[model samples]
Target: MIERILEQSKALIHVLSADRRTRHLVLTWQDTEVLESIHKTLHPLQEFTDALSGEEYVSISYLKPVLHLLKTKTLAEDPVDTDLTKSIKSRVIGYLQDKYNDPITQELLDIASFLDPRFKTNYIGKENIPAVKARMKAKMEEGTRKEKRSRVRDTEFNSLT
Candidate 1:
């Protein structure tokens, strides 16, 4: 039954990609389902990687399990086949975009691209995020300074009067 599903999936994926005029797009329903399952199974790994890396809110360790899981599933032609790193990366980016409201960073995007074509052109660049962070930090500091100054002024006024 599983084998049947995998075969159909490969055919369907090939058909769909071909239909879309994508000559090499390949992923059948079984492969798609398996990839989804792999994604689901790797949630814990991502959490672990995020916690370990101090980038808990923005980590991609969840991908490892998916890749590993793909090893077990059979491909259309091969007994088992896994997507290239680029495909994995794009999926990760897509996952993050769908799951989180945060803007995708260039560093992460680059890492994804480096990892797989799935990440190709997914983000703009790293040069912009830092300026935004810096500006936000500066605004916060400025607000704090103003609050402290107001409190000091109040204290001075009370002491003098």
Candidate 2:
């Protein structure tokens, strides 16, 4: 919405400024500057939000990589950013870091992404890879044992019948 308005700003500003009743609604230069800064700061986040919202494509494993991209590329402060844009970027980066900084949460993400074939170990921290691998091994072995026990039980029941 803001993008569209900004795109047609010249025409819209002329129309709004020309009308007595709507003249009061015309955005001042300062207001447009602030709005433009805000729009620029937040525009990159929309793609991340939309990608994460999808059930078919998104998975828990995507969160860590997406956050990494957000901090390193999408939300990084640019040299040309206005003060307001820089501040907004900083707060968003800070929020994402704090939100995912918990030890358990980090481990969960590491394990999930590591288990995923498409990303296995690509995004996992070097320090975390060993632990995540160990957990996956344990789980796979546990599943194998359970399967063996179930097969044995079925065989015993079939023999009795």
Candidate 3:
């Protein structure tokens, strides 16, 4: 009888441990789903980076398409979604908006994108193109002015010598 009781207790412990493991897995399954979605959405972007040269790959313009893709993927409803997943998605959107939504940065990205012959403002919206072009023109003028000033300084120094 003692041996039978010991065997029953061992079985009970095994069952309880299994139940605890199942509960842990159930609780954490949502995290796994979120991570899997992130991996799936970003894997292609990673592969794209591998195909680009250093300069093109690191440009701020690359963030536009990547952010678009990530927003599209992460904002969609998922079967196993949880609040944590939603929070992560919101944080990503917020971060991108905070870092790149300003006019100056947007203008810079537009200029960089426009300078790339492969794109050349083709991807920029019609409404924004005029403003971006204006900003680009202003920047070019500023550069030229600085260059002229530097040249004048150089001539003055040469004359003094």
TM-scores of the candidates in the order shown = 0.31, 0.92, 0.52
Q: Return whichever of 2 and 3 wins on lDDT.
A: 2
Worst 10 residues of 3 by lDDT: 1-10
Cand. 1 Cα-lDDT: 0.50
Ranking by lDDT: 2, 3, 1
Q: Per-residue lDDT of 1-161 in model 3, one digit per residue for the tens? A: 33343335546555666885554433244544555556544454455556444654555556555555556664544667566655655676677689888988777777777777767776676798998789789989999999999999999999999
Q: Give all candidates' CA lDDT scores.
A: 0.50, 0.89, 0.64
What is the clash count for each candidate, in the order shown?
10, 0, 0
User: Which pairs clash in model 3?
Assistant: none
Worst 10 residues of 2 by lDDT: 50-59
| Residue 82 lDDT (model 3) | 63
**Backbone clash pairs in model 3 (N, Cα, C under 3 Å; residues 3+ apart or in different chains), count:** 0
The list of candidate 1 runs beyond 4 A from truth reads 1-80, 83-93, 101-125
Q: How close is candidate 3 to the true structure, as a TM-score?
A: 0.52
| TM match of model 1 to true structure | 0.31
Model 2 residue 11 lDDT score: 92
Q: Over 4 Å off in model 2, which ranges? A: none
Stretches off by above 4 angstroms in model 3 are 1-57, 69-95
1-161: candidate 1 lDDT, tens digit per residue: 44454547767665667665765567655656676555544544465455546653433533433333333332112323245433554465556446543455434444443345443333424565455455557878999999999999999999999
